[model samples]
Target chain A: MSTVRVENIKKTYEKGQVLALDDVSFEVKSGELFGLIGPDGAGKTSLFRILTTLLVPDAGRAEVAGLDVVKDLWKIRQIVGYMPGKFSLYQDLSIEENLNFFATVFNTTVAKNYHLIEEIYVQIEPFKHRLAGKLSGGMKQKLALCCALIHEPKVLFLDEPTTGVDPVSRKEFWDMLDRLKARGITIVVSTPYMDEASRCDRIALIQKGKILELDTLEQIIARHAQNLYAVDADNRYNLMNDLRKNTEIVSAFAFGEEQHVTLPPHFQDEYLSAFLKEKGHTGIKVRKIAPTIEDTFIKLMLENQ
Target chain B: MRNLVFLLQKEFRQIFRNPTILRMILIMPIMQLIVIPLAADYEIKHISISVVDQDHSTYSSKLVNKMTASGYFQLVEYTQSYAQATKTVGDGKTDLILTIPAHFERDLIKFNKAQLHLAADAVNGVRAGLGTAYAAQMIGDFNREIREEWMLLPKFNEMPQIEITSANWYNPHFDYHLFMVPGILAILVTMVGAFLTALNIVAEKEVGTIEQINVTPLKKHEFILGKLIPFWVLGMVSITLGMIVTFVIFRFLPVGSFFTIYAFSAVYMFGVLGIGLLISTFADTQQQATLFAFFCMMVFILLGGLYTPIESMPEWAQWLTRINPPAYFIKIIRAVYIKGSAFSDLIPEFLVMIAFAVGFNALAVFNYRKRSA
Candidate 1:
């Protein structure tokens, strides 16, 4: 069954000058870890706010756990957990106090559902007496998650929960989400990092307030995958500027030390090397590479444009 | 109800943990209650007078002596040149000039009356008016004494005289402290209640905590009341502290029952705090909230009739005071504290205060939406 059903949702701000969401629609099945993957200003936060009933859609409807986002807001509020993109916990309160406060606000007790957050809580429990403001970034995130989950909400909405977190903590956070999913909780998480898209069971790639692609990880890449190439040169910067100058190159984006690019169908690698050699380039090497989710995302973004 | 308990607990914990708020709630009232009353005393004294005594007679000297001995005026210039005295008045050195013409007490002995001239610098109208009145009173007393001595005493029943006796009621000594303490206390309670509740919710918005709270199932009134109740308790504690300071510094205690004051304050706080909540609902940031709160408080306090009597205000201003929440409370507090008025006697003010509380709070709760538009 669909736990969340969004139908052609449209939202705008500043007297309709800025369109935040346009005809956005999707569904999250029960116990599914659905991801909304997009860059900043992609309407991810706006969509989450609408589904969580914190905002009203300008011209569409949404539901959470079969409860209408507008008419049944009170019922939805009791069942859904929303951790906003910004750190919203009271900074002056202790970790334990913050957790207990949210629990009580939901008309439940922390002791009643202590096992739900126990895995994440035990890590932060050592510093439970410390003020939330005093904790490091990763610990603050964990405490926020614990507070959001204290009532064992059926649907959890986490907006960019891993944005500012370090790599190791980000991995640990995903592990915690995996465990929560095992307990049959539906989660809708949004992130700006394209690499994290694979961590979800399904993702809807959103851009400019519109969903570009929505599919399973393998299905999305298989349907739109192309022959991507990673090229290296003596100078990475010059290599990128040089590659963009060629009409044969579909797109070239700098990815760390190597520049990943898509070439025209049936284009020979030697022809590119020969073309660069004529432009005073030397020691150029190119090889075929598997397309990453980021590469697929870039291709979809280019196609939409 | 359970949700409200948690919300209240969180608000109180945050309030107590903030040292700045702690000091504001505890220290501000006592300090202002003690210092403002002492500096705001309105009984005018020490008027400087220049006596241009052209007639150096005994009566002229006696009148000047009586003026100085009255403790209201000082004999600054005793010059024969009226130009010099006029110059002193122009220079702001003297506040008044009394000219005893060259009668030399001859006119008083020969005729039944003598002429004397008194001129006051009417720059500061109140000071000049009062100084002139004091001088005229001393001269009148001297004239009466002269008539009693120089002329034969009138027959006991020859002149029919109607004597008027008057007594000061309420504050018998006209104690400025007693009159000002309760009024100032009313303002202090108002300021604390209004500003604190105004900033509380907005501060949560700034810190981004309201977003989380808004997503929860906590009802609108529960959240607002949670913000209010703690500050309401603090406001009452402030009034108690201010009263203690009033007694400690001035040895003045209210003649009315303390229960009446608390009952009135309880109702008064709801109205004042309701205004603060109303402002909070309209503002998005702490800066906006503080500015809105300051604007409302300035209007309420200025028109509150604490500094000026409502009857003396212009008709429009008096009309405005009728709607001012603090004005009603200030009048109620002063009446109860000084006039020993019981709560039953202040039914009209109580009714008005209840209206304000209900009207403002309803508007606030209605304006506050758990869902964004």
Candidate 2:
């Protein structure tokens, strides 16, 4: 059964002049970890806000725990936990105080649900008496998560929870989420980091307020129906320009230190490498490469255009 | 209701944990109660005078003696020339100049009356009025005494008779401290309750914790009530401490029902908290909230009759005071403390305060935004 369902969710700001979410629709299974992968302003935050019932969508229906988001917001609030994009825990309050406050807000106690947040809370428990404002970025992030999970919510919605956090802490946070998933909790998380998408059971690639594709990481990669190659030379910039200028190269874009190039179906790498050397290019390196989620996202965006 | 209790607990923890806020909540009221009353007195005393005694007679000396004996005027300098006396008054060294006309004892014997020129500085209207009245009363008594002494001839009973009787009500002693202490207590409660709560919420908005609460299971009504109720209670506690100090140190206590004073104060505090929350909703930063709350408090306290009597203000100002919750609260407190009025007499003020509280609270809740948009 679907734990959270959103259908044709459209949200606009400034009297519908700017569309934050346009015809977005998706679902999260009862126990699956779903990821909404996109850049900033791609409507991920808006979608999370609508599902969490903090905001009413301009058009569409969303449900959490089989209850309508608008009509049963109070019921939804009691079952679901939410952490916004920013570090929004009470700063003047101590870490323990913030935890107790959120727990009490839900008519529960930390002692009742301490096991749910124990892994994340233990790291910051030593300094629980310290004001949250004085904590480091990673500590604040952990405290925020603890507060969000103090009630053992059935479904958790995190909007870019790892933004601004150190890479090590980000990895640890994902590990915690994976453990939570094992406990049969539905997790719907949004992130701009492409690498984080691989950990999700399924991912939705969104851009410009539209969902381009939604599928498993391997499935999305399987849909890259093109011959792709990575090309490098002593002058990377010159190599990229030459590849983009060539009519044979259908699409050429830089990826990390190497440039990813897509060629016509009939084109062969042996012929292209020989042709490059004959054209006065030296020390050329060409190799077949696998498509990443980011590459698939870019290709989708390009195909849409 | 459970959420409200938790929120109130959080608020109390926040207030007590922050040393600065705690000090401001407790210390400021005490300072205003003790220091402000002493500093805000309007009663005039110890007016300096320079006497230009042209007569240089026992009669003139006796008149001066009577003026000094009144304890309102002090003989600062004795000038032989009128110019010197005028200069002393002009330079602010002396508040008045007493010019005794040059007259022989034969004049008083022949005329039965003498004229004394009194020149008083009138820049401070109230002090000048009091000083002139004091000098006149002293001179009049001296004249009566002289006439009585001259009545050895047994014909003084033929003169015209004049009688003056004065009665003061409410505060017969005219103690300014007694009048000001209650008003200052109201102002202190207002600042602690409204200004502090408004800034606290706006600060959360600025720092982003409001969004955290927004996503939680906390309802909007619960959140707002949770934030306000604690400060309201704190304001009442401050008022109680202020009243206790007023009784212990100043020997002043309310003559009416204590329950009525607290009830009115409680309702008025709600209005103040609502105003603060309204300000918080509109302001994006703690600084903006503080400044706006400060501005509103100034207007409310000024119109609340803390300094001037409400009846003495113009009709338009008096009408405006009707909407001011502090005005009603101050009136109710003063009426209870000073006049020993009962609850029935304060029914109208209590109703106005309740209306203000409900109205402002509704406005605050309505204006609060749930979404960032």
Candidate 3:
């Protein structure tokens, strides 16, 4: 059974002038770690808000844990724990107070759910007497997670939790999420970081309130029909400029140290290397490589445009 | 019910944790109750007058003496020439110039009438108007005293005179603070209820914590009740504090039952806190809510008959007070405190308060969107 199901959800803002979510629909299976991958203002937060019962979708039905979002919002609220993108715990409240408050409000206590948040809470336990606002970003993240899990929610929704976090803490947060998922909790998280997509069981790539693709990391990359090659040369900018000026290349962008490009059916890497050498005599390397989720997102964006 | 208890606990914790808000809840209202009524005393005390006695008759001198003895006026200058007295008025030395005409005493004995020229500097209009009215009353009393003297000496023509006796019943001394303390207490309570509640939900939204709370299973009415009850208690606390200050400094006590005052305040808190909630619902930020609540509070207090009587206001402003929640509280508070009025006498205001409590709260709760539009 699906833990969460959304069908034809649409949302708009600014009196319907800006389309925030456009007929967006997807499903998260029970106990699956699902990621909504998109850029800023790409309707990721809008979708999360709808699924968590914080918002009403314009034109669709969303069900969480077998209950309709709109009709059974109270029931959905109990089963889902939502961590908004911003740090929202009361600044004046001590860390322990914040945890206890969230737990008590949920009609549960920290001790009742102690084993669930035990791992994360221990990391923040030393600073339990400190104000929640005065904690470091990583500690705050853990505290937020602990609060969210205090009631042992069946599903958890995290919106851009690791956006501003350091890479090390980001990895730590993901690891903590992995343990929660092991306990059979369905996790739905949205992030703009393409690298995090690889950690999820399935991901729905959304943009402009529309879902472009929904599949696993391997499946999304495998589904890319065009062959991709990484082009490297001494002058990275010039290589991208030259590749873009050529009509034979489907799309070309400088990705870190090399340029990633898609090719036409008959395009050859040897020919491209020879062409770049002809323009400016230098050593060049061109080779085929697996596309990342970001590369796939760019390909999907180009196809839609 | 469980949700409400938890939510209230959270709100109270947050309120107590913030020292600034705690000060606002505890100290600011007490200070205002102490300071505002002192500056708000509207009674015109002493008006200086320059008298020009064109006629050096006994009655003219007696009238000047009567004006000076009234305690409301001071004889700043006694000049034979009107020009010198006008110079005193021009120098801002005296607030008014009183000129006695040439025939002063003979006319009152013969024609039973004499007119005095009184010119008041009307810059402070209320002061000038009340001073002139007071001077006129004093002159009338002087005329009656002379008439009574003439009647005792067996006048040739004893024209029948009507006597008017006036009494100041409720406040015999017309103590301004006695009249004002109850109204000030009502205002302090109104401000506490309105301003604090106006900022409550919006402050949560401003800090982005409202989204977290919204995602919880807390029911809408439970959340509103949670927010409402804490500030309702604070509102009553402000009134109680103001009453204590009123008692301490002014030695003034509410003439009516303390139960009546508290009962009315409890009901009035519902209406005032409803106003606060209504403000919070319409405002998105704490600053916006504060600005809006401040503006509305200014209008409500000014029109509330706290410092001024509503009967003396223009037709439309008096009408505006009908919708203002504080106005009814002010009236009921004054009626109960000064008039020793019973609950039945305040039934109309009580009914209006109940309506305001329900009406504003209903609109506020309706506007509090639990599910985002």
Q: DockQ for each of the predicted structures, in order?
A: 0.65, 0.49, 0.57
- Candidate 2 CAPRI category: acceptable
RMSD of 2: 5.5
Can you tell me which runs of candidate 1 are displaced by over 4 Å? B48-69, B74-165
What are the lDDT figures for the candidates, one per model? 0.89, 0.86, 0.87
What is the per-residue lDDT of model 3 for residues B1-373, given as tens digits with 9 covering 90 to 100? 9878877887888888878877876787667767887888887777998898888899898889888887889888888888888777778888888999998877867898888999898877887899899988888788788867877876567778787777889998877777777887788888889888888788888888878888887778887899899999888887887788778888877788888889889988998888888888778898899889879978988998887899999999989999888888888888888889988777878888889888988888888787772
Q: Is 1 or 2 the stronger prediction by DockQ?
A: 1
**lDDT of each residue in B117-148, candidate 2, tens digit only:** 88888887777778888888888888788887
Error of 2 at B227 (Å): 2.6
Q: On a 0 to 1 DockQ scale, where is model 2?
A: 0.49
Shift in Å, residue B188, candidate 1:
2.3
Better of 1 and 2 by lDDT: 1
DockQ of 3: 0.57
> Regarding TM-score, does 1 or 3 come out ahead?
1
Best by DockQ: 1
Q: Per-residue lDDT for A1-305 in model 3, tens only? A: 89999998988888899999988778899999999999999988888888888888888899999999999999988989999899998887899989988898889999999999999999999999999999999999999999888989999999999988999999999999999999999999999999999999999999888899999989998897667899888877778789899887889988888889888768778778788888893768899877888889999999998
Off by over 4 Å in 2: A128-130, A225-227, A235-254, A261-286, A302-305, B41-165, B366-373
What is each candidate's fraction of native interface contacts (fnat)?
0.96, 0.84, 0.84
lDDT of model 1 at position A68: 97
Taking the candidates one at a time, how many backbone clashes does each contain? 0, 0, 0
Interface RMSD of each: 1.5, 2.0, 1.7
